[model samples]
Target: MNDDTGGGPARGVSGGSWERATLEKLVFATLKEQRSVRRWRMFSRLLWLAVLGAIAWYFLQQQTLGAVQSTPHTAVIEIRGEIASGASASADSIVSSLKTAFEDRGAQAVVLLIDSPGGSPVQAGIINDEITRLKGLHKKKVYAVVEETCASAAYYIAAAADEIYVDKASLVGSIGVLMDGFGFTGLMEKLGIERRLMTAGENKAMLDPFSPQNPEQSAYIQNMLGEIHGQFIEVVKRGRGARLKETPDMFSGLVWSGPRAVELGLADGLGSLDTVARDVVKAEDIVDYTQRENLGSRLARQFGASVGEGFFLAAKASGVQLK
Candidate 1:
């Protein structure tokens, strides 16, 4: 009976020990898992902090670069690509760059390094007006040195320059305006697809590609374009003064070689950015004051666009209605 009692006590002690060991193991395992999770969370936080620090550093660097005041130099503002609103070569950006360059005491003269086919006339006009105003305000000379092609709206802005220099082979001129669109009414007819477009105003659907062209609307548009072309001609005449050699085809939307342009008085001389800076401006050191889209701004724009697209898709999926 004593042996049986001792065995029962021993068995109870063994079972209790096994249970305690299992409980301890489970606690350690849970602790290990928690530690791993905590470590990952900490790493993610640090990574985010590092990214933020890098972005801050980039912005600070850009500001520092912009704020740096140099010795006497030829300040250059590039009017490249299409000169339209929201573009890098937009009037707002060019005007802002011009203001900075003209305001700088170290800048002797401002140079416009132009290379563009052209874009919005309104944008070009705004830039041209601002250049003239800034020149008068600062008593500084603005030179336009054309590279490759400077036509239409590009030439409109260049007209405001004190002098226009171009390469011998560069294409210049094309001082005209145009409205372009694709007509799909015939295509729709061939496919037996009918357009059921409704508009409150008759002219609201005036230039709709899917609909038939209206003679009255076409005439009105032509007249408007002609008026704008006249305005462009006036601006060029005012800027170029007597230097412009008038021709019937000068404002007929035709491009000319650089030498031909100089001969016709569209360009003053044949020169490049380097030559203009070194010889004409007399300030060999050229400093670019062009306002470009920074990396941070680009990233933000892309992120915003992505978010907008996501919302649009979600709304479409949910069948959201808008009036």
Candidate 2:
């Protein structure tokens, strides 16, 4: 063996084996580094899975709602919610529902089973106008059956109906226009708050409820109320025609029970929803058209509404200071 050179055949073989062992260690370390990269990718994949699950849940909810609305039905409609613009009997809600009902082939007639204390005049007028137009176009029979109360704007709407029925104790008729606001003159004085109002016109702040009332202002307000009341009287007379009894006390903003209403010629008969549906509309099926928002959606809407209201209040409080 060439021991001096350390390159004898056997010695050379041992050196080559040592070099291969060193190379193997480096390759194993590189494999472990690649494994660490794979572990990071797995973690990211898990996060994306959670995100996808949430998205899938949202879509599933939406699909469920869509399916529920797709269910079909028959017969008359139920108008048993509050009547107001943007409040309950919103124009959009009522008109859309009415349109759907009219389009339904099975629906023979539209029955307004009303039981409300009345609300927004504009909303009521719009609804009345729509009802009139729809009746003329479709030649459909529309009946207003007052359950408990159909006063003010509610009665206004009822006038548009082909016929009106009421229960014995139902309070109907508040045919008048009235505005209410607190007079904070005393409270402001008591609290030592300064009154600083600047108006471009004399009547710009004519109806300011915070300021003291002058004789001229009082006369103006009375005249305005009288005018509105006159409008209400005219509408009632037009709708009821010869059916409305001519009496000095008829337009006295009097509220009467259902039985009293019939005596007063405000309603045609006495009955309830079922009686009206079976007897008048001749259909027992009822459909609701009012908006149906979920609790979360409703809460979100309420939150946004309250926020907007607070913003306006802050602005009015800072500038107008009028009640």
Candidate 3:
């Protein structure tokens, strides 16, 4: 028999070569997979490091920026927007900023730049108390400058200031308390819808919109509101002292123009922030001492709440308002 026709060295050499080629291909594929995994791992690590670095930089900027100024300037804390808990004009932020501004030696005087319809009597009271305490401790003067409107709780806060300045046309003086909400009981009745509510206490669902109005509850609410209104009146009286001219409509939740407010002793005079910074404080330079939320703080606050939610909770709990 011929060697080529049978299983011989030539056929064996070809089979060995084929096996070697397959082995080499398998090794290459394994190396390639490992390289891919390593690349991905390195990329993941780099991304994580980048995130950490960004966070660190952001924090560093927040700590260092606007911390020091060479010149003596008027420190301004903005009390704009709705005054509620955790808001920019809230007691926490406003009081903290006021403390910082007062503590700063470079700041000649602290200015509260206010422009709002006002909100949250408790929050405003906290800020007002802090301002008074800080003034006594630091011996720093606080001037409230109103841009547009400083009614209700805003006036409560402004009353704590040394003096209040407003534009001629600015609306001011709604020093009162009120609780406003829509009653859906009538609407539900019109729609022939019955609300099924169950609670541990009869007063648990006291302010439930869908429920029918209870006479006892209404009287109780009115009494509570009256007490809080008395507190508000006391705060304004204490803060304003003899400056507040006692009038029937002053604390009756009536709003007034800036000129009329000055005439009624609700405001001191008509002046803008620029004029006050330049003429009153005698410091033409104005430095903002407002504790504004940075990116990190804002992101953290996103998990928190809004002003409306705070007002709702306050109303639900206290059945009172300074809005």
Number of colliding residue pairs in each model: 0, 0, 0
Q: For each candidate, C-alpha RMSD in Å?
A: 6.9, 11.9, 10.8
Per-residue lDDT of model 2, residues 72-127, tens digit only: 33234445556765655676767776776666555567777787777777787788
Which has the better lDDT: candidate 1, or candidate 2?
A: 1
28-121, model 3: which lDDT tens digit per residue?
9999999778666655655554565577568748654684566899989898999998677888888888887888888899989999899999
Go through the candidates in order and give each one's C-alpha lDDT: 0.89, 0.72, 0.84
lDDT of 1 by residue, 2-41 (tens): 9999899999999999999999999999999997786666
Residue pairs whose backbone atoms clash in candidate 2? none
Please name the candidate that would achieve the greatest lDDT relative to the true structure.
1
On lDDT, the stronger of 2 and 3 is 3
> What TM value does model 2 have?
0.68
